[model samples]
Target: MKVKLTIKLLISMIIVYYITMTVYVVLNLVIYNSNITFGEKVFSVSFNISKFMEPYIEDLEKGNDFSLDDNNINKLTQNNIWIQVLDKENKEVYEVNKPENIPNSYLTAELIEFIQDPWGSSAPTTISTNNIAKGNENYTLLIGFPIDKIFRFKMTLTDESFKYHISIIIFSLILMTIVAYIFSRNLVKPMVSVVEDIDDLKNGIYINKKNKQGIFKEVSKNINNLSLILKENELQRKEADKAKEEWIANISHDLKTPLSSIKGYAELLKGDQYEINIEEAKRYGTAILDNSNYIQELVNDLSLVYKLKNKVLPIKFKEENLINLLQESIIDLLNNSKYSNKEINFNYYDDNIILDCDKKYLKRAINNFIINSLEHNSKDTIVIVSVLKKENNINIIIEDNGYGIKEEDFKNIFTRYYRGVNTSSAYNGSGLGMAIAKEVIDCHDGVINIESEVGLGTKIIIVLKN
Candidate 1:
């Protein structure tokens, strides 16, 4: 996303320069160095003529009868070359009928021979050489040939090849510039669309449809994902607001019934026309007190649920024996007056399960499951709580023979303030019990699962890691 145009352009330019430089070097080497035989042919012909006249130098130095053959020498130096032979005294012993129009520099030269034969550029016909033979006396041989014209011809061809390579390099640079522009444009296009979407979002315009492709396809995908998340959150928020209003209405209705009954009975006692027994009066007062306490417990549970949802409550996790905790929680639940009349069956297996957990939070989670069962189950039905082992985890189950939840509502049963169809008629409790249980499980990085069939039974399973 942060890719800069200048960086892209720089890289493209470097590639173009490298390719052009490589092609230029290759063409130059091929035209000059690779053609070994071309330079050698000129050298070979010049060397042959010199080699053929080697015996004449010895003959003239020894004062033997020697012929100075100008016609043959003239024929040998036909190819734009000036040939000269010098004697032992450094005097010119032989000269070809060289062209007068030839440069004067070629005609006047002193020559010395190297022990190692000159190779490459130096071995060409431009070289001048002198050879000496030492025995009882010293004899010398010198020869010169001008080859500047051949060098000029080679340079001209090289210049032409370089000119062609320069033109190609210019065209290639232009092509690379075009390619870089297209590539950078394609890469940035999608991001531009995402930026525009952000501007729309800021102005309170939520566009959920994803309508972009190709170069900016990934950007579009990310935008679509963000849009979906926002939409889901908006829906949940609206649902929570509606639930809040319903909860207030339900709480008002519930409080009104108990308060109205207490008010009516108290008025009867205050009226002198009504004959009220003292025991009956006490019973009425106890009923009012019981309902008030229920309200208080309901309010307390609701408060805790809110804290858990907002992450205001902190959990203290530790390693403990889950079996002891489960048994203790059930005993505590049964001690309550509301659940004392309900038949409860406990099935515990020694699964050797030990887990790191917040003891109080997990106990609350289990208590929520028990309370849910008590609230929904039929009178005289037995509720079962069991513990078992799974792979590196402990599975605790609380089951009741109750009218089970609908299949459609299974996934969202643990959500906060989610009351089912029979909630208003069958139960009188805040809808945050299961939500609190879910929060506790999530804190332990565990999971909760439920299995149920309508009008048969409901099973709640909590899995915690060991």
Candidate 2:
């Protein structure tokens, strides 16, 4: 990017430089070859003073009157110029459109001084003098131009000096061009890098090239940070997509199993060839109902998780006794005959610790944690639930001395559809329990933290505002 931009800039500067040199050469030609100044070209005068007075100078040399025609007089007046003719005696022989301050007679010394320093005089006019002679009688013709219209400067230069000055000017211009090019290149270098980096980002390529020294240092740092964040997000999205695929497969299998059972039992009940008794029919009906309920529970979990994730789940916040809410969740779990043999303990000193929360979702989250402990461990494994008030916050801790979570699983514990590696085949689940619980806690503006070591135990802490 830098190379391309530098080349383009160098080309542009060269083009501009050459064009300027061309204009300079053309203007020099125009200035030296004509009496008309550059600014006067568009509105050129009919004739210049030197050309107009040339014919009359011959007449004055032959001893004729240095007089002008009406047309010449009008031309001189319009161009703001005056002419004076002086004869041998230093007396002004003829004058046209001359200023009042100009004396009709002059001493030779005065005439020489005025001619030498015309601009230094009070009149401050630019004067041009020409001498004409006939039969040893000499005459001078003087032309005076407005000071504002003409400027005169006298310069003395030899060939060598002129060449040396021209060489110096050319060298300085070259040096200036080189310096300007270098400065502009440096200025645009960082910008080129930035634009290229942005293009790479647009193509989903994230690179962290740190520019530590330059005006763009901060800009480079910010872009690199953004790249890192985007890279991380991209990785997360891929992981989520993989997990989603796994979840769909698992859900399909789970649904198929219950559906197959329900279908089988219904078929058995409907078979006329098999002479089924009322007791047998009742058993078949109960089996079918159980499978149906299981399917419905799975569906409900799926729906609830989607709502929670989308932040569309309505939460009815109200003050409730924390102790009672936890006890009720424990009792509900204990009421399940499958987990009745599980050893669970609830410990709390405060019975009236009040909290503002969505009772339904909060209770569901708590039940999920408790059930997770019960289902994942041996029946003899001890589980403890405790609630404590810390300053203005409430902490509910669930601990268990069970086969703790593996490190790999622990990292993604709350990720949707991520069942633990040690998940039991006997106890099937939708794999949305932990994810749902997390979402529920988040909706209540709460935090959940977990600490677990393999084979020792797992401790889960839920903190909520009081």
Candidate 3:
């Protein structure tokens, strides 16, 4: 059977308490039977009895009569010990009710020996004696009890003590059980609550928050935090699904335009719709090739986006001159028929400084940046570029006085397929320019920063290794 943590803790604490009480009881019993116990009590009763014996001894030492205190005698005679008063010569002159097997009189040396090594197996563990003075005469007094009889007397009193002992045991059991219950409940309550909270999460239900204190406060707070994270993730998943649907629609639109052109041109070429010459044939052929190239370009862009996003593209790195690469990319873009009319200017201030670079990817990143500016801005827009060396870093800055990004869309400008509200269809294109640029720069262990104001302009900063 599966046991809950609370039950286990309760059982464990109860077992420990039981073991502790059992040990205490047994230890008390052992101490009662040991020689140390005998040594401790033997002198306690003897001192009281000595007070009664003082007068008896002083008179006896003078060969006169003496008396005893009956109450003191009774208190001192816990064990059935023989009590006696003797003269200096060790002759017994008086006797109290003593235990059997103890001799009436003793030679001083025999009594001394018995005191040193007590005599019988079931007798007093040892003897006790005291001296008295009477007119300068000396006397001795002795007492002995049976060890077996003393243990019997103790057992008799212990029988009576069981009434209170059993009461104490029952009382203690009740108290400890209550304490154990409270302790185990506190220890296990938080964990059990957490388990239930997890179950609620699995059921797609939010956990109800409650005020908790002590050690469980952190636990409750963490559970709430985890709930918030899962809730946010759930919301993000829904938004991503919606965004993906719109993105697929946009991609379909981009693909249809070129495909329609290709199909229409091929049909025209195959038809007898009009008379054709070399010039017309060449023009038709160029239009067909242009549409095909446009479709090919779209496919290539999608492929590169996926490869970079999934990290499936193999990239090779070699030491290349970044300053030269940037200048050439701009010059080549100016040479291209598409961006030929765009007024692009660049300022360079460095020689060939070598750095590890993947030529195709890095050049693509710079081209994407330059093209975004030229294509997005008007023909009158002036694009300025500068390459500067600062200690260990090479900084490439591109600035354009074009229609800038809106503040709301600035944060998401690099997210895939996220076209800003202010960006027109002519400028945003596929909405993958900045995202791809950022990813490529990141792959090179470099950084890209954009500073744009609503009506003024946009400036891009690319920092790379020198």
Of the candidates shown, which would achieve the greatest TM-score relative to the real structure?
A: 2
Give all candidate RMSDs, comma-separated: 13.0, 8.4, 12.0
Clashing pairs in model 1? none
- Give the candidate order by descending lDDT: 2, 3, 1
Among all windows of 10 consecutive residues in model 3, the one with the lowest summed lDDT is 148-157
Off by over 4 Å in 2: 1-4, 10-176, 184-190, 210-212
Estimate, for each residue in 22-86, the C-alpha lDDT of model 1 and write its tens digit: 99888776655443454555443233444544654554344443334565455446655544444
Per-model TM-score versus the true fold: 0.56, 0.68, 0.66
For model 2, the run of ten residues with the poorest summed lDDT: 38-47
Q: With candidate 1 superimposed using the best TM-score fit, by how many Å does residue 259's alpha carbon deviate from the native? A: 4.2
Choose the strongest candidate by lDDT.
Answer: 2
TM-score-best of 1 and 2:
2
* lDDT-better candidate, 1 vs 3: 3
Better of 1 and 3 by TM-score: 3
In candidate 3, the residue pairs with backbone N, CA or C atoms under 3 Å apart (3 or more residues apart, or in different chains) clash, namely 123-147, 124-145
Per-residue CA lDDT of model 2 for 207-284, tens digit only, reads 888664688888888888988999899999999999989989988998889899999988888788899999998988
Clashes of each: 0, 0, 2
lDDT of 1 at 439: 88
**Model 3 lDDT tens row, 226-296:** 88788888887776676667778887887787778778878878989777788988888898888788777
